[model samples]
Target chain A: MSRIILYTRFNRFWHWTQALLILLLAVTGFEVRGTFRIFGYLRAVNLHHGLSLALMTLVLFAAFWHLTTGEWRQYLPTRVFLKEMAAFYLTGIFRGAPHPVRKERTAKLNPLQRLAYLGFKVLIIPVQFTTGALYFFYPNLNAHAWPAGFLWGVSTLHVLGAFGLLAFLVGHVYLTTTGHTPLANLKAMLVGYEEDA
Target chain B: MTNMTSPSGPIRPPRPGRFIQALAGLMVLFLPVLATQPPPGPAHGAYGRVRAERNRDVTADHTRFKVLQGPFKDGDGSAVTRACLTCHVKAADQVMATRHWNWRPAATDRKGYGKSTHLVNNFCISTLGGNQEACSRCHAGYGMTDRTFDFTKAENVDCLVCHDTTGDYEKVKGGYPNPAVPLAEIAQKVGRTSNQTCGVCHFFGGGADATKHGDLDDTLLKAPRSLDVHLSRDGAAMSCTDCHGARSHEVAGPDYGAPADRREQPRFAGEAVSRMACTACHTATPHASFVLNRHYRKVACQTCHIPAYARGGLASNLSWTWSTAGRLKGGRPYEDKDANGLVTYNTIHGDMVWAKNVKPEYVFYDGSMDFTLLTDPLPATRPVVLNPLHGSYADPDARIWPFKRHDGDQPFDPVQNRLVAPWTAGPKGSGAYWGDYDWDTAIRLGMEKAGLPYSGKFGFVKTSMWWPITHMVAPKEQALACGECHSRQGRLARVKGFYLPGRDRAPGLDFLGWGLVLLTFCATLVHGASRVLASRSRRNP
Candidate 1:
């Protein structure tokens, strides 16, 4: 096996922490909406706020680390093989087809995977974070400073980001079950190891 | 074809089984992620439970009291009184007090009071009749079946009508059919009904008995302007007790007299006390006019409209009355006599004054309105003596005169102590002071001077004065003005866009809401486009 280092310890830490925070956010978000009460509302809200702050800090750290290491290049999108990747996920994956692009030590994610992850990071995450931040600090902001319309717009955008995240989660859960084995992907996330092709 | 067959083989599809396996793994991981995460706790649980229980109680109570008590007409043209009371028997008193009990035929005979002789006709009853099932569905209560029930007993409207007892009833007693239970047991078995119960009654087409004074349809009820105070369909619904609970049952008489004893008759108990009613839904400032201008706070509604006591009697209209004779400590007469062979004794009767003394800064009335008496106050005359022991008597006329008073310093303005205005500008013998009030002119002038909209109906002369008086009586003229109360009816007529007389204008939030939507859309578009462009660049690079 060509033992080329792909994910560093800090990278893995950020990834896992981010994933946990996102999960916590989803749980607390839904609880706030009153779908089902798992944690008491007050506790859920407290935890939600705490986790949101942690997520923000982690994001800041990750951004700094990425900028410092020039690793933000990992998320640079490419049109090459994008259509093929989409097709593979939609249809070919169900028919036992091979992946159009493969992961290597230097190129850890395929073109489509990179694009999707970049979209989530740059677009969805930022939108949610900014909107959420604005909402929390809304009272502190000068009421007449921002156009009243803008505040409303930001709130709507935040809600849309929430919906986008939800959609991603659904697809993500489905894809997780489509791993080499039912437990394979899950084991990898927990133990920080995956099957080498 | 030859090249395809030559070197590389056919493209292989992804393994479906592997994908399924990965998905299963993800779900498994997700499950633990949820499990390890603590569940939402007590506050959320309590809120949920209270919300649910409230809904149940309200629904149960509404169905029993308002919906089922009908002479519901089925499609087959037959009347059917549903058996809602078969399950709930305790809501009888609640149903009776509500406007629903009198939802029968309007008294068509016009001879009783000067108005139409009939007690007000419920729109539902007038249009749908007691036999219509569709009408009965919303007007639920006891005695819904046509042939099986008596309308007189009002047996259809029973207790547990608005109260939902699904969980509590099951917990307290084994089942709902247990009749050999104590009142306390039944009471304990019940839980508080939510705002949902109120919604059930207050909802679209449900409580819209258009013939009634307070009837509001769904369109009016759901208008944006009505959001703060109006009952929402899905949001918090207020309960009957929320507005009615300031008083309880033990209080007697509509006069608001002091309770005989706290153990026997509690003060503020429910027996048609309007002040108690006002305090229930309103806090911060209870009296509408008095809250804004504190001068007229001493006068209560019961003081002017004499309350008639009816322990086990039928309903009666309020009339004016004045006490004539003063009773001694032993319930005997006290007398005073004068030296000129004239006798003057202690008499309780006083002159009728239309407007009570209030601060001039707060007074809303124009000076020209007529102050004619509608009904003469009772007890016209009494014998009096200046000195009772000396046996000198005098004749005294004790007629109650309804006269208008202006806002001036009490016991200071010469006009305040006397019935007549000292200064008169009208021509002599013109009868201008004696003429009936020109209410429309007065109201228009008053509203214009106050900088308020005068778009409401001056339908009749009595109402013109009455409306203004009611407005003046409200403590806060700014928040609870004559226009606010009258505007409900006026708005339906499309009169001035739901303007309340005294309230500071509410900031419209619709534009803000729309603006938010557009902003969110643009943000999402930018975010998605940026991701797409980044992905393309990476692919090329």
Candidate 2:
């Protein structure tokens, strides 16, 4: 049997809440883009805005939790076995080769996963938040004489962030479905647990 | 180790599953309801009855404006009334005569008048297939869609459509009609509701479904007007009269040259007195930088401010239409079967002539071949030059010119001779080459040759002797100031570029802005694709 250890209450809470918020945001965001109008545009916009705000707040709380608890080390990328992990995903997966890296209590992600998650956490999310916040508060900035190309540049960055988020969502959905059972990864997110390998 | 290890492990506390489950149950039972429930009604134990009291309050407030009648009633069963019309009864009459009121179902006989025939039948006339709740909100008055209420006697327009102060118009009557009334009040007595007044009807949701205009949704509405040119940010913010100026009881009347008896006068006399309505606000100086720095005096505000009128069709998009006259000497390819016994061979030779025939009687100067050569310029046959060069000529020197009969001293005396100059003989066999000039090109060339600084290219050549004669002799300074006739507020401004959204950078800013947006959107697609590929490889590995 796999041993259970202290996961810390806030860590589990942040992980589950952030995951749910991202999923909700993705659904509404796509709807707003006119991909499929499941909920009406107004409703979708409301949900998207609400979830985005919630996610932003969760990120703030999670950052505090990570810093105070020193759990931010989990996302620190490593060069060890990075190339092997990349090779395994690119070609070895087709041949049913074993995974090059393993997840443990101390290090929960492979080197490649760590790097990708690090980019998402440190770069992509910040860009999206900054751009979106600026867009939201544009009316308030009316007093300021914006630079000649400022609005265009900021809007472009916002759209780019939107596309990046969309890609991440598609990959996430696909990976979740690719688990041992069709719903195994989905259940792990919901319950905050996974079966031992 | 053997001594320390007992059969049973160290004593431990029982798992707190029950306690946690009880806590979760308590949260589920109590916390969410507490978090989500709206605040309770006022301290009155008869809170359920408060809604009735609120209706009475609204009805009492509305009564101050106008009397109520018909099946319409407030929630408290008081008769519904015309609240807005009470204050703006005079203005309402003027509004009804304008295009805004005419935006309804066309009379069956009005078929040839373009899209005016395509009526939006989406309200009380739903049997006509135009009755949708969404369309009625903008087109018809308020409360038309209330299934529980009958608005049969209600006017198509409501007071709150323009005076949307409180979302519920009844509760907030005193919020309007304060003391800051202007000296010449263009609009009726209303408060500081400018753009907000217009936005009540123009904005997304409420009653208008944006899809009717186009496939536009709420997200599209959120975009700035600069991005979507169809939208007017001002239209969404200001009252109709803020720009339209003065509620005239009369319609725009007929075209400028309509018969006098049939002509309609301006609704408000004051509106007619001042050019301040649309033109004064949209001054000749639109670009602050250009006006200050370039000393570019030639460019008028209307030069770039072209009005885009709504096209006439069901899919009525906005478009601009410009008309130019071209002279063709062949007389529209007509075969003149009847000619004099001389058998004048019809040689189709026509140069784009801009010269008008000078009557013999009005010859301030005799320039025509016959008049100049004749030893004694015959007073009866004396043709004064009507070629624009003759500034003001005597009636005797002018010929029996039909064009001049209606103009100047000839003064179009219908009783004396119905025939006008130029066409005095009615399409005669005059060998004189006469036709319409390409006025746009001719005027440009004339301006340029006269030492006028214009920005546009002149396509035609000014070969007429009249060009130099008129420039040197006529009021040169007055004629050269084409800005007097072509300025933003001039009659030509109305004729040429009918709609100008205040002078900005360029006339085609809308197109340029859209192009940039499209280019950036394409770049985003490429970037997204690359990232997706990179992510897929990482995930697969």
Candidate 3:
């Protein structure tokens, strides 16, 4: 086995920072929902706003790095080995099966991984952003043009999206352990290096 | 160059100590003189206030003038008023038209019957005939003796009852002025009516002090800042007329109590007169919280700001049952007092129940009330709504309002199928209910005077009258909390207009949410366990 550069310095930094922000948002969001008592509703609202703003700033920097470094192409998904990767995860992986696709700088994410990451960026994040932004700006939006139940509907959508994101997080964490060794894929994301499996 | 102070040799900065020392010496010499001067009088602050000197806008002085000097003490108040009118002619006509002088109003807003005119109350019932003199004691006029008392006669208007600055003046059952009050002195000292001056009648209206309104009483005369920040002598020092502006003798605000609608609360300067409202001084949006401010569109200012009424240790009557008024002891007229020391039973009036720190009943009113008047047919089986709140949650102009709902019983004509007028006041021989203790004779005289046909058979009808509350404002910190209206036990829990989040929930939604969360956790645990078992089986094989 040989080690190679799979994650860049900026990429690793963005990943960890994004993880920390999502954690803060989830805790504060649940508090606002009357699930637990941490900071009061008012303080929790303020902190959620601040964290969201920070996450937006981080996203801007990460988007620029991805475009400039040509790493944006790593997430572009393909049909190659898509069936084999799904089958391996469903059954063969529990029987100690081999990975259907290889990981390198050129193709960092396998086909299924590429599909999940792309869908999350284009679909789930945008829904969360739109719903969250609308809640914060509802005051500025007057009542004449909107329906009476618009606010309640928006709130429900945001909470549902949060649950979806939490499920994705659980799956993502478990899949990272499916590399050649349990800690190999995690070490690559942490230290910017991956060993051939 | 050496004369240039040996450059760079211990650069010492010039000190201001000598100047300071000289200033201190001068201060010591002037200290005694400065101490002798009086310190400035207290400036206005949150602690309270002192009344500002009255600003008299008019330039005329009647006391020194030659035209006002003759026949001042002669005949009745009319003679004095005739002299007063020589200079100010239109004043009597304006005073005569007001609800104060007439003891009646032509129209109450856009509603059908006037509030004080033909519409009867659950307390003391109708002031139609025999009760005229008893009820008219609070009327700003003199000699409204019977139905025959002329409304056209300007002499009947008592200007001094309101304008007198002496505060000793009293108007009794016959609308007769207290003979002790010197008419000449009252005529001379007539000015803006003090709170003490108005309370002479208003505070003592409805047969006693604080009996009619839960928010008003003698307690407001020297109210502290905590009791009333606006009217307190130690707070804003505002007079009644300051907030309730007067135009052509009409006071700007709700005549009975609360403003009809939000628009009536504040009128643009010089615009047509309307009910004076709290939002006039405190703008509709006064709170820093956008959530609380946004509530102005749907909830009245008083509902949140006035956490309680009758908070000044003054009791306000909540109900009066006229059916119980006939109780007597040993054939003599009797009386009893409630636990709160309010009238429970009396020979003339009936049972009265009162309360303090009273929680107001919430309702959505759009200003109009279906006032039960003499002319309207009475509801037989249902509780007669003397004046019910007229709007619902669906009304755009309507909002949740606080009300002091007085509930009791009044006599109704079973034959005429309408409300009967019962004479209630005067000396016993004059045929009042108090004098004769005979509802038959009293109703006959009352119906005859009011020109309404008596049924000859009368029964007590249960009724409820509402007074919208706009006073007894509590401090900002004491205002109703967010949870007060948002929780299950909140003030608005029983309000029927709209759905509330914390106070209301659909059981289906709750069950569905719990079910979905459980399914997710169970699915994860089951799938993970099955995968682990299969991995071990493969390893064993």
In terms of TM-score, the best-performing candidate is: 3
Model 3, residue B106: what's the lDDT? 38
- Candidate 3 structure quality by residue, lDDT tens digits, B1-541: 1122334533222223543463355334323322322443342543222333233355667578665454455326676667677777998898877766655553655343443467777666677765676777777666776766787787777877778777766666666776655667667767766777777776765667777777778888878766766667666666677666677777654543344454444335566444356666577777765556867766888898788777778888888888877777998898888666766777767787888779888888776566678878887555787886777655666678888888888887877788888877756787878887888888888888888888689988888888777777766666786557755567887896354434544435445554565566665566567667877888787
TM per candidate comes to 0.31, 0.33, 0.76
User: Lowest summed-lDDT stretch of 10 residues in model 2 chain B?
Assistant: B467-476
Clashes of each: 111, 38, 6
lDDT of 2 at B507: 34
> After superposition, which runs of candidate 2 have C-alpha atoms over 4 Å from their true positions?
A5-13, A30-41, A91-98, A173-187, B1-541
TM-score of chain B of each: 0.27, 0.27, 0.82
Best by DockQ: 3
Task: Give the TM-score comparing model 1 with the true structure, all chains together.
Answer: 0.31
By lDDT rank, best first, the candidates go 3, 1, 2
Candidate 3 lDDT over A1-197, as tens digits, reads 34567776667667866776787788877666555657655456556776777777777888898899888898898999999998987877777788878887789899998999998887877888999888767655644246656666676777767766776776677677778787888877776776565
lDDT of 1 by residue, B478-503 (tens): 12222322222321122121122112
- The alpha-carbon deviation from the true structure for residue B209 of candidate 2, after best TM-score superposition, in angstroms, is 30
Better of 1 and 3 by DockQ: 3
Q: Per-residue CA lDDT of candidate 2, range B421-535, in tens?
A: 1111002232111122332333333223223333343221111111111100111111122232223343233222111111111334434444554555564455445545655
Descending-TM-score candidate ranking: 3, 2, 1
